[model samples]
Target: MAQIVGIGLLVLLLAFFTVFTYYAPHGDKAMGALAAAAIATFLVEALQSFVIGDIFSLGFFQEAGTEAGLLSGVIVAFLVALTMGVNPLNAAIIAVSCGGIGLIPGFFAAYLISFVVKYMERKIPNGLDFIVVVIVIVPITRLIGLLLTPLVDASLLNIGNIIVVATEASPILMGLLLGGIITVVGTSPLSSMALTALLGLTGIPMAVGSLAAFGSAFINSTLFHKLKIGNMKSVLSVAVEPLSKADVVSANPIPIYVTNFVGGGLSGIVIAYSGLVNDAPGTATPTAGLLVLFGYNPAAQVIIYAVIVAVISGVVGYIGSHFFRNYPVRNTDFD
Candidate 1:
């Protein structure tokens, strides 16, 4: 029950933020800005967390982490600005104020600060605007963040713990449930990388989640091609990112989602059955996840097993897509 609640809360948060940030009014601009911010954040994080810390075996950046903190503030500010539909100056002010907060809290803080700023813009007099906005708004936003951070962080940690415990308790059942859900979320506009990172899922559970994503991508692409639902290029691109074929996905959402569940469930069973484990993040793709399997199993065995799973998943997805065959395809510009 606790595990269910944890997973449920995580899903609710993801879905809510996704809609709020990407599907609401001004969503296109917000999404574009968010994407840019995500790229900047990923580059900095990879450099600090992976390239320097993991590959170089250096502690220079690790010891002096101030740069990362500053970068995070800038990125969060940019995101807040985008969300608020404000100019750069206002964004910088809010970002500086909201610095040192985690992603979820930062998101809430940005919205709250943006709302207050908008309200003040309408209500407050124009005298001493900089001080009023900067000194007043920034601290209030930061205070809200400071108050919310502990609660949000504690909730996230508890959810992560529940996922870890649930996976350990019954790898197969949890694997199936998580595998299906994660795959669907990955194929959606939301980031699978972000989702996994938020949950702090690792080992067998992570392996199963990654494999499920891989299976769903394979299934989606293969079925798309075989059914002529999309062009070859679009179908192939679905493996890397399903949103590339958003037209097809949106047109046949039920079929695609259901197929993902079936294919992902089967893939999860395979992971549990084989007892495969993946510690690496971003294993939500077949190439990335299967390549990592080389570390734990023989290359030939991994290749063969991956092939078998892909074939099974593809076949299952193909069957599932047939249910929506009669659904009309709507024309939309992917350009």
Candidate 2:
């Protein structure tokens, strides 16, 4: 029951944030801000671990690292605040007050604070609004952080563990289901990286999920290119990020989903059956993740299997896409 609730909460939070930041009114600003925060925090965190931590041999950035900890929090707070229309000085102050929290909790805190600030901006009279925000908003949101962070962190970890257990229990079945589901979400407006990281998905599970995403990208690009459904550049760009060609995807979502499902399911089966593993998080381009398979499997075998998966998925996507003739391609600018 706890596991179920934790997983459910994680999914709900992911969906809520994705929709609120991407599809809601004036959401582009929020999305942009979120993107900026993610990039800043994730990049710095990755570099500190992959580079600085390695050199220091102290793991100086492994989530609780002293040197890189507060820096990430301040960056997230500053970007989120500026995006919410706070002045630089106030943004700095608020950021410092929040201190360092983990990414998931930090994001929640940033969103809550921003939401409240935006609301108060409209509701409060101009004469004393800044003073009110500085005096009240910062402390209140920080308190919320104090209350929510531990719960969110523990729940997220539990959710990850639950998924790990389920996958281990029935690797083939869970792989097929999770692989397909994760790929669809990845190709959608939601960020696959964020989802995987949030769930702490790694090893074989990561391999399955990443392959599923790659299958979708390969399928979409191949089918669109073969059919001349959209401009070549636009169609090919789907290989990197499907959302880049949102119009094409929205028009023919069924075919895309079907192809992704078939491709992802098959790849998941292969990963589970062959015992492939990957410790690294997947890249934006799914195929890039196949390289990690080499860590556990032979290089030649990994490459061969990857090619076969891509070819099969592409063929399936191409054939399945023809069933949706009602959805015509819309004109789009490559730039």
Candidate 3:
């Protein structure tokens, strides 16, 4: 309960921070959406404690973490529609794709950057070398979890030996300490999803709600952006991409970025509570991190939650792009 309060406070502060930062833009809609997300976090947590507990088994936690990813898909939907400049009437497509393929953009964008820079590296002319970022590309950011997974079991073993040596002095503290040590060992960031499975602690349904809100907003953005769709043309033969060109979808990524954080984080917290942990050795990131859930035997509520997130993501992305801000990319004067 207290944690929910803490989360609400953080979201509120974040909301103010977002608005203050955008003071020049003064986006009332964007600001309002942030406020809504904060309120949502509070309501969802409270509901999870009372209603979900009354109605369903906590066994749903097994799917919480995976479920969170659905909301992030909205961000993907927003980006895709913005990039293509498709019209508002076509939002359904954006919603569908975002729900279906939200993670591909980031992963592929990273891949494209890598591929292009690497290709330019060998082909750069001597005088042109400085002008080109031929070598300035790295795809797939490394995750900390991947590198540290090996030491998990061995470290636990060493701690167990230490506890054995201390047992004669004060067994209670030693036992307490031992329990603490094993708990840490069991919940290693890389391994907790599986550990949760072993413990069978089906957490409440906070995570599913998180997923639902995220998906809802994402779908909302997608549909909204679709409604505002336009087209673009390059004035220059070779494009001079800006530092933040990644944001130059047919619309901007600002709204989507904000949406992803709120939506994604909520989903993550829910997953943690739900007892769903990603067991894959590598960092559970990108879509594969969560979409992997589709493979799991999810609680019935989670599937519904996913569909909702998809719809919201599309809707939010659409409205956010068209209503709040206009993109320069959609208005290039090629002539």
Candidate 4:
């Protein structure tokens, strides 16, 4: 129940951002489109973890049925982003991409465009980065997809087999793993790719981890500004980019270790207290941790408890990093 509701809230927030970016009339159309598209692509990527196994994944369909991936709608949206770069078009493309990989034709299409864009831009008076989507980005995506095809296929079959079994004893433990530790670890320098795996194993904790990871950093930076802790105060005031130089330290295992030790600990305690349960089999990392908290819809009361813990973790993460982090602040007058 908490998982479902949290996802719902996240989706709504994304929708809001998409709409706001789309409706604005300005030079930022490409950026807006990119934002919308990035989120959408992630959403589509998530289907594999949350919905049908690899057998039903877009990559699976593309590998088995044809060389193609993505729906007609996705292709059209991609084209739209190319031509207009409007928020509406990009947002749609993003939504569809995230909805399913079958709808994304991989990056081969992008690869094709890279050359065309580069040549035309050089040949003509003005150049455009618009082609990077298909060329550099999409081609890489396709290559990775092709490479991962076998693993994807085998894993899906395996997941289908194990899900029922995992439902019994896996979720809570997995949830704790994810909520407590993976959250911090995933955000560190080791690998964000790990986060994708975490999300798949258990959508719930991963989702919390997602918002908590970024926002908690913001909150921490904000708090320092409130106090008189040098220029981190000022830099964090704007989220033009969502991190600080402390990212170097923050990326270390120590920070994540400290974070998950407590974050997921809280999540685990709550899982036990609520008695709500998980019914899914999953991979390792955070989502695997979610296995403990499935099936049972956490009632309104339980949801509140989860929220409290999440909030507490976010605050803790912020404060912990804020004070403990050692990074130099940029001087405003240096430039």
State the weakest 10-residue window (summed lDDT) of model 1: 42-51
TM-score of each: 0.69, 0.65, 0.29, 0.40
RMSD of 1: 5.1
What is candidate 3's lDDT per residue for 221-327, written digit by digit as tens?
34234533222222111011111111122133344334343343334333333443222221121122234333343656456545544544444445555654553
| Candidate 4 accuracy as lDDT | 0.37
Tens digits of per-residue lDDT, candidate 4, 138-207, equal 4444454355445434433342233224335566554444344333333322122223342344344433
Model 2 lDDT tens row, 1-335: 54466447645654565456445544445444554554445434434442344334555354533344345556666666777676666566667657756544554566667766767767877656678877987787677667877786675565556556667678777676666656655554344544565665667787776666667777778767765667778677777656555434534455665566677777767766666665655332364455445555577777776776787677777776666545564443322
Model 2 TM-score?
Answer: 0.65
Estimate the overall C-alpha local distance difference test score of candidate 2: 0.60
Compared with the true structure, what per-residue lDDT tens digits does model 1 show for residues 40-153?
A: 453344345433454345687543432553454347555756566655667677877767765546655766677667666667665455467787888887887788878876
Please give the ranking of all candidate structures by TM-score, highest first, separated by commas: 1, 2, 4, 3
Each model's lDDT comes to 0.62, 0.60, 0.31, 0.37
Worst 10 residues of 2 by lDDT: 46-55
Query: Which scores better on lDDT, 1 or 2?
Result: 1
